[model samples]
Target: MPNKKTPTIWAIGDVQGCCDALQELLNHPEIKEDEHAQFWFAGDLINRGPHSLKTLRTIMQLGERAVCVLGNHDLHLLAVYAGIRRENKSDTIDEILQAPDVEEIIHWLRHRPLAHFDQNHLMVHAGVMAKWDEKKTLKLAAEVSDALQSKHWQKYLQKMYGNEPNRWRDSLTGSKRRRVIINALTRMRMCFEDGSMEFGSKDSPFDNKSNDIMPWFELPNRKTEKTTIIFGHWSTLGLMIRKNLIALDTGCVWGGKLSAIRLSDRKLVQVECTGKRR
Candidate 1:
């Protein structure tokens, strides 16, 4: 019989180009040196902070020991890098795109899964749709992964960016279909009472009180009730501690701090973020 793989993991939140903060987090004492740790990122490793290339290279070097799901910012990085989109004047990913190791980093990043799972929990960039659960998600994520890893994938990645079909259904098609699924996995924010998701809600808890929409995790009778989900991409949601959900965005891109929670012991580690992209 094969020996069981030793389990050690640190499910970290969005890096968002915060290379310094990421360094601090990785060097944190609780990370445990003796154990072979597998790092899982909620993604968004570039844009809006700084040192995008350094951050990407560092993770790329880690290779299979680390896995990052696609965040909205990560998709944006790929888009800009692939010439499907242009970098804004305020963006800093050019450092990554022009780095000597840029192609290698992008190659690994472009192939990253949109969701990952091990024995205990599932990790995604934002939130998963209620209907798919973790197992189903990993399977579907593989489908998308195969699409991304294909030789002609640049066209697919370019095709895979947009927001339509706000709710999941069995019958969506073309780029619009792919884009909606991608957005939900990587960029979801709020949902209505009837379980319909809202793409327009980036507000903090105190920002709005219309009472018609709430964060997906806050929705009553959530479908993935039995599974613990670790997610980021909603800094507005901040550091949340729930019974089965770990929300670790921590506003790291908005002058907040980068955060990582040790899954073995639920230890939260953080480093102050300057929040400036340069």
Candidate 2:
């Protein structure tokens, strides 16, 4: 008998509806070369690129071979589908919203977890809170996931738009708590030293910054510091590979490369984008 091939897991950066770029990255010699490959997407699978429908379909078709966490854009798509929010001018998700399989696709996307952990790697679309250990992070993530899959999910989406109560607190309750969890897991880029999220900074970390705001991952004495955290929401921060954190959003929708990193060996594979979103 032939030797059983070990599964090779690839954590890919945000695709953001750039299906062509995703396909190109998948076909790269490093990725396609592995017959037993699995993919973990960092999220924002749709919006602001050339092909939202194809992107969602392709990832949906992956079934057991792919794991996706929800990102801000993903939630926006769900909000629009639920009639809780209007489509933005930059959104390219109309194809997905109008598809024959729209219901099925939305169901799949809505059910996706806010965080996923496997083999000691914690994956979220954005940063996990400094106060959350691996177990707490997973637990808090489930709270939002439950809300999204609940019958009253539309009600939750209706109240999901603001940035109020920007810090996490154990005493937080109801939709406010879920909203904070969703924002931290899907949209956070920077935070204050106390782990309260900072919404105003989107520039790369290389840019000048006040001492008061630091990247969420860099918060002092983070609880999840020991676990390897994989995230993708900050496209401007690009690809940052550190001892315990990976930031993989290389801005494929903005004409940057689509990136993927192999889990076992940390090999990097990338495909350059052909055009910027108009």
Candidate 3:
């Protein structure tokens, strides 16, 4: 019998509507050689770039070969689609909203999970709370996923915006509970000493001068510390690869390179991006 090839898994950082860079990365000689390669996108797949519509469609066309978690920009697109939030002047998702198959697109986007676990790695768009282990993190993420896919999804979207209940509490329920889960999984960057999320800082952790806040991954006793946690949404932190962590966002929309790393051997691939978010 011919031996079956082991599929290569490429974990990609935030595309952020940079379809040109994304396509280039996918077409890189090393990546294209593996016809059976699978892609894992660390979300923010659209918005803030010149090709939001095409970028989203490209990933959607990948079908079962792609695994994408939800990022904050993606969730913002949903909010704008739901009429719960208005688009900012810099937003680039108007094309997607006006597309003929917008309903289908929204359906697909909303159904995406906030967290994904595979290949012995746990992936989320932002950061995981110190209190939750892999199993608990997936469970909470699923709860938000169910709410987003439910018949009254808009209601959930309406309640989704907020920074309250920053700390994780097992007793949290309803929108407050979902809010915490969504914020931590999608928008979180730093946390107070108590592990309550801090949303104001978008700068790199090293640039953080405050003594009270620390990057979520650096928090003492993170449950997923031993698990290989792959994430993005922190472009300022750039490409960070560690024994137990992979931070892939390289600010593609801000003229940085689009990055992808092979999970098995940690092979890195990158493509330069023209600045799109001025």
lDDT order of candidates, top first: 3, 2, 1
**Residue lDDT tens for model 2, 181-264:** 988999899999889998999999779359989989888889999899999999889999988888899998999999999988
| Per-prediction TM-score | 0.93, 0.96, 0.97
lDDT of 1 at 223: 66
Candidate 1 Cα errors over 4 Å, as ranges? 1-5
Whole-structure CA lDDT of model 2: 0.90
| Best of the two (2, 3) by TM-score | 3
Clash list (residue pairs), candidate 3: none
Question: Which one wins on lDDT?
Answer: 3
Error (Å) of candidate 2 at residue 258 is 0.2
**lDDT by candidate, in order shown:** 0.80, 0.90, 0.94
Q: Count clashing residue pairs per candidate.
A: 1, 0, 0
Off by over 4 Å in 3: 1-5
